[model samples]
Target: MKVIGINGSARKGWNTQSLVMKALDGAASMGAETELINLYSEPLKGCLECFACKRKGNKTGGICAIRDNMRPILEKAHEADAVIVGSPNFFGYPSAMTRAFIERFLYPLSSYMMKDGQHVRLLGDRVIPAGMIFTMNADPKSYEMMNYQATLGATTANLQYVLGYAEQYNSYMTLQFKDYSAMNANMFDGDQRVYRHETQFPIDERKCFEMGRRLVAKAKELNQ
Candidate 1:
């Protein structure tokens, strides 16, 4: 079994990468081949709306026609038993890189067809186990107030619809900086902003690990 983790964060060694790595480690523990792809390091372009993949009788075989760094990654995702997508929340949604990666990943596999006189997903018969990790600055209670939960829910629904099974892990109230002095710390309550990164971050990391392991287990079951 093989599981691939994709990190959408531009900053290395940050919260998003940490969680993705931890998840890959967990999958590794399950005797699954694991790999991590950092999107920031790759030359990925957004979907060009070229309709090449959607063309009738196209020969692409459910793969994006765009020839770039993302093409190989999308192919890997298509072949992998499980995929873990990690992205830091930007403006209550996924970062641009993450959004682009997902679009390219899903678009080619999607097809329009009529079923029972209604449009349906042609590739819906294929099922893949997938997981998502989101790191955000808002706390759980404030996620609704910030509208992050609703926006993220829609993303999760789309993934589930396309991938068959999808789950998410959230690390909320993330520390954006190592030192408060590096940025305008006055805007945040210093006392409330003081997060125990050393302690709590590990807990979040363990959750990511479990998510990876769970995906692998589910994929294995499906394969069986």
Candidate 2:
């Protein structure tokens, strides 16, 4: 089995990257193939609403038509057996890089639906199981306090609803450090402000390792 992990943290060796790597490590240990895509390094574009994908009788769903950086990653994500995305919270949501990546996912499935006589909910539950990792500044308690409802929940919640293949969720956080100075001292020497923030500065290093291993276990549990 193969799985892909995406790091949307924008900074290398920071909280989001570390966590996504960790999860991939776990998947690797289980003999499952995996790869991590760095969002910042990729050139992704925003949705132009060209409607070429939605055009009737077009089987490709406008996926191949959009000329942007997200095309390759989106293709791999759809083909993988399990996929995971790791993003740091920015204004209570995944960073802009990550958000843009999520939008690209709409293309392929939309195309599958428009294809010639293939009808079964293109992105339906049985397609492939997926998961997400929110490497934010908040603690698990925050999600509990909110009753599992919070702004950071927008992406995962939407994916689960739309794709119905969401199989697991894992998190690693560094809470309460909101500024660059604090984050530099705690997480990545101030260079990773994109990942460092108040309420969550540095993720627990051990947890990073554990979260990754858990992903591998999860894949086995679900698929086997």
Candidate 3:
């Protein structure tokens, strides 16, 4: 079994990447080969609407034809038994890199053809369990007030529709800075942020670990 993790945060080894790594560690514990790809490590662009993947009788084989840095990442994502994508929320949505990655990743696998009144996916009947991780500065209440679920939920919904199964996990009130004293952002209580980071982030990590293990198990069962 193979699982792939995508970290869409520009800051490496931060909250988003750390959670993704924890999830990958959980997958590895299940004896699954796992890999983590940092989206910021390479330059990638969003889907250009080239219609290459939409062409009838095209030889693209369900892969994007853009021929960019994301192509190989998309190929690996498709081949994996499970995939976990982690990104920090920006303006109530995932970061630009995450959006770009998914635009290329999911669009190619999507099809206009309908079956049983449902849109067909190039993935066929294969079940590839996937997870989305979002880290944000808003607390649970603020998140609810912002209605972030509607924005982020769309990605999870599309992943499920295209890849068979998908789940989302959000880490609320994430610590955005290592040294808050240096930054001019005084709206937040630095001590409270550190306290929450020390206490709540571990719980989030554990939950993400379980999510990883559970997704791998689900993939094994469904794919079998």
Candidate 4:
């Protein structure tokens, strides 16, 4: 089975890419064919508030009126057995790149479910198994983007239960740190330091790699 990854980080190969690559590698190790797609580089944006999918005849048939790059991604997205979406939490929510893709992908599907007066399980068996990874830079006591998880849950549920695309299990990883040790006199922000006491790279590269591997494992389980 082929698994697909959509990286939603604007920083190209930053935390998002690193995390997604790990998941891809884990999937590869399990003999699952996989591909990673970068959403930021793709030409697309959030829903235009255009009700074309819901207002027009595209409902139930799962057609998006917006004929753009999203069309191709939608085609590719459906071809996969599993999808892993990774994004860095931005401004108390997912990045714009991720939000844009989700809108198009779920709009038609959800409209079909809601537009009709029936409580029909439009999602039924059409939904694939999906996983999500969210990363952020926040300290333990800080509520940085803490509310994002709820928003994600609501969106995922609507997409999974209403649109019937996939089951959504999620993983969360964050870095709590400060470049200036003066921020925390002890240089201790709940056990982990922002930078290695003496490493060339300050970030936790190992954690990133391990997370990738775990994602792939989950993908394999879902595919199987």
**By lDDT, who's the top model here?**
3
Residues 27-106, candidate 2, lDDT per residue (tens digit)? 77767788889989966776676766667776663254576677788778777766778887675677888888777674
Q: State the lDDT of candidate 1 residue by residue for 26-101, as single tens digits.
A: 9999999999999989667888999998787898877889888888899899899899999999988888899999
The lDDT of each candidate is: 0.85, 0.64, 0.91, 0.60
* Poorest lDDT segment (10 consecutive residues) of candidate 4: 193-202
Q: Which stretches of candidate 4 lie over 4 Å from their true place?
A: 55-60, 112-118, 144-146, 162-224
- Give the distance in Å from residue 90's predicted Cα in candidate 1 to where it truly belongs: 0.1
Q: Which residue runs does candidate 2 get wrong by more than 4 Å?
A: 61-64, 107-120, 140-148, 167-224
Model 1 lDDT-worst window of ten: 188-197
Per-residue error (Å), model 2, residue 132: 1.3
TM-score winner between 3 and 4, please give it: 3
Clashing pairs in 3: none
Q: What does the lDDT come to for candidate 4?
A: 0.60
Estimate, for each residue in 1-224, the C-alpha lDDT of model 3 and write its tens digit: 99999999999989999999999988988989999999999888999999999998998877889888888998998789999999999998888999998898888888898889988868777888999999999999988999999998888898888888999999998999998989999998888999999999999999999989988999999888
Residue lDDT tens for model 4, 1-224:
67778888876666677667766675666677888899977668677767776764444355456778777776666666666677776765678888888777767666444435765443445545565666665442344346655765665665556433443333333433434454654534533533332241223344444544554455455444
Of candidates 4 and 2, the better by TM-score: 2
Compared to the true structure, candidate 3 yields what TM-score? 0.97
Top candidate by TM-score: 3
Q: Candidates ranked by lDDT, best first?
A: 3, 1, 2, 4
Better of 1 and 2 by lDDT: 1
* lDDT (Cα, 0-100) at 84 in candidate 4: 69
